[model samples]
Target: MDVNRRNEMKKVIVSVKLRDILIGILIFNICIVIFSLIVVGVNKGNRQLKYGNTENKQIEHNNSKVDLDLKKEKDTILNKKIDSCINLYLTREKRIVKLDLEQYVLGVVSAEMPANFNIEALKAQAVAARTYAVCHTKHLVGGGCSLNANADICDSVHCQAYISQEKRMKTWPKKERAELYNKVKEAVESTRGQVLSYDGELVMNPYYFATSSGKTENSEEVFKESKPYLKSVESPGEEVAPKYKTQFKFSNANFTTVMNSQFKGLNLNSNIIKDKINILERSQGGSIKQIKIGNITTTGKMIRKLFGLPSANFTISFESTNIVFNCKGYGHGVGMSQWGAGVMAREGKKYDEILRHYYSGIEIKTLNYK
Candidate 1:
């Protein structure tokens, strides 16, 4: 009985030892799996952190670019404003007027064109006047138009007709002054910084006139230089001008004396004056190109100046004791016709259209000093 009991005890002890060994193996496998999971989780966290840093860098770079663009835009605008400011000389006052370029343009438009004209016409005038000022400023830099050496421009018809607000008020009716002033001011403000350009450059000469003689004249015909944009164009419906058809009469003796004195080489004989007068050539626009008086050939421009004629489009005839001059228009007939612009504006043309109608192949550009 003692041997049997000892065998049972030995069997129990072996079974218990086997069970402890199996538990130990299972615990080792579980520890291996836990270590692998921890390594994988740590790698994932590292990747996320790197990606987050890259994303933040991209956002910061985008923000920096936006700020740089805004700053550049602001600088450009500031430069433009500074460039637009020009110095003007009021010749009548004999003083320099430090006015904004747009304000000077306003004064020019008001004094140059009638305040009662169409809004579009007024805008066109404003652009033209501004362009004229810019061209003069450039000319001033190049040592041209030296009448006012210390000025960007002079305030005269020689440059551009300019009237101060105080003078304009004095000239206008007390009740209507405010309304007229506002009308001009609106036109200038609406077309601020606008100018006419040809071939990507500003036009040096922006000639304008009160009326055209049926058509506008070529620049070559009037100014001896052909400007492609100032080519002759039809300007109809200017018959409504107050002095469209003016008749000037002078005594034969007086006319002969004036002609003889004006024409440097001409010696006039009163008896043969009627026979010697001749219109040698006419421009395509029908203005007298050249005239022959006795032995001297002179331009119609000279004759117009000598006789105080309204325009070069005139027909001279000897009628008994007087020389009759039947004139058609009232200016140099070079570029923009104010009356034609008015008629076009009245007929529902915009300011740009009016400008294109008068100035051929031109671009209306806002002067960007930047």
Candidate 2:
């Protein structure tokens, strides 16, 4: 009976221990499952944050590209506006030619002035040419060249000498053509869209001429009209011009015939004509303002034309073989003298200084074409 009791006790104790061990294993497995679930949830949240950041960066890059495109579009629109305002010009060939304003000025400069002149002198010429063009457009009131009613100005010096690029290329030597063209083009571009004004008004007629004898003439003296800007001013250093001093000799018969033909009322006695030709008055520029031939009193301009004299600044003398006219200067001796400007530029005078010296009380301003 004792042996039976002991065996029953041993079985009960073993069964209890086995149940505790099973319970411990079940608890450990449950804890491992809960930890695994928590770790997986945390990993999923980190992946979503990384994805969101990558999308935000892509959106910022896309926005930057859109901004750059908008800027480029704006720049193109601005360029068109500038072109529309400046690319309309009329040509003498009865044609409406489209040319950039600066380019037109370059052609005019190349034609109207020597290419070898100083850069500052060329710049001054460009500004003057531009102002002249703008002024003509305003004064024309939509009118055009007298010869061509549809043209703004002729390609001749009668208006402003303008040579086309094709003509320039044909006329200039092949090696020198591009260099000469660039020189003039640079002058125009450097002073692009610049014009001259006086008392807040655009200068309509800025006259310029070749070499002056010693001084520029007053507008009243030359044109019979006073212009405040065009005043008598001493122009030095023009004596260096090649034709600054020239002489014209005419045979007695030729001189008499020319004089009689021009003035029908006059009968010239060749023997006494030398004594009769006398300068009565001289302008401030030392040009012959008035002269007396026999009993006819006329302006020096008439004598210059009748005798084919280069300028009105001359002294008549009788040579053993012919009547000689010793002349000075080449043109009307009015406004800005080309040779004078060259000299001034060589002396380190800027374009503005040169212009102010010639055109008194003037202002250099930007083109205000509406």
Candidate 3:
């Protein structure tokens, strides 16, 4: 009778174990189903875009059906990468040194300023960007440029970060492949997110300094490497270039003439605007003559219109450079030049050449996702 009791107890335990196993399988299936449904719903939704301001939520567009199919393919094959993107970014010393592929792409892509940009350029930028994303999945654990994860300033300012612009514009300059790749890769690898606020909102990219006349205004002003004040460092070497005639030297008459009309294109009093320009001189080291409301402060020469910011603040300093006013590059003279890159790309050069022109001596590597 005891032996019978033992056998019966064993049978009961086996049944309970089987029941637990079956329950576990059911729960797993349910989770999978729910997860799959959520994914489908999300895929169906359009990717919303917000520009300089978000009060007005503007959706750039929804991708094509073909694009969606590709996304699906990528989603299936690289779900691991996508999941990694959703995970919390890792940081060290308050810098976002670590990011998944998606976050990396987000950081770099968001930094681009491609307004009515080129398809080929977009593809090229994406291809180069993706290569870095895949390569530096885990190893890109540190940032070098303007990035403070907690500050929301990561990759925003001093860093060559992504800004919203047209993809088609990238093709205009025509840069090489290697150079383009390097530039994009450098930005992705070095930038970290900051947590600062600008205009009551977060400052996405915050570090900005001008390199007027090719010297960081501060660097040249502080270090008088040249005999004359007007001289500037031309090539990337220690020696200073010869000083040239400055536009500031307007035969005293022309100075007064341009000064009167320099702020001419716009409707602003030269006298009132002159006051603002004077402030930038003591404040910015660059001598100023023309000042306009709503001028993009970064790239002083380019009217805010080209950047799509019709109303911007910009102060143009008429510094002495014997060279013609017709310019080669764009922007605040502090960071990367897409125009320069485009020129190189158009010339059938590599991305590396483009990167070297903009940034100096930055290493490229791939980080593991694990």
Best by lDDT: 1
Local accuracy of candidate 3 as per-residue lDDT tens digits, 103-134: 55544544563422222333334434444333
Ranking by TM-score: 1, 2, 3
TM-score of 2: 0.72
In model 3, the worst 10-residue window by lDDT is 237-246
| TM-scores vs. true structure, each candidate | 0.75, 0.72, 0.30
Backbone clashes in model 2, listed as residue pairs: none
Error of 2 at 357 (Å): 0.4
Give me the overall lDDT of model 2: 0.78
Pairs in clash, predicted candidate 1? none
lDDT of each residue in 1-370, candidate 1, tens digit only = 6999999999999999999999999999999999989886996776544455779867888999986764554334323543665567777678886677888888888888889999999999999998888766632223224667767777876777887788888989889999999999999999877888776666667889898888999999989999998989998998999978899999988988988887676888777788888999988777899998899888888889888999999998878888899999899998899999998999999999989988999988776653
Candidate 1 regions with alpha-carbon error over 4 angstroms: 1-82, 138-144
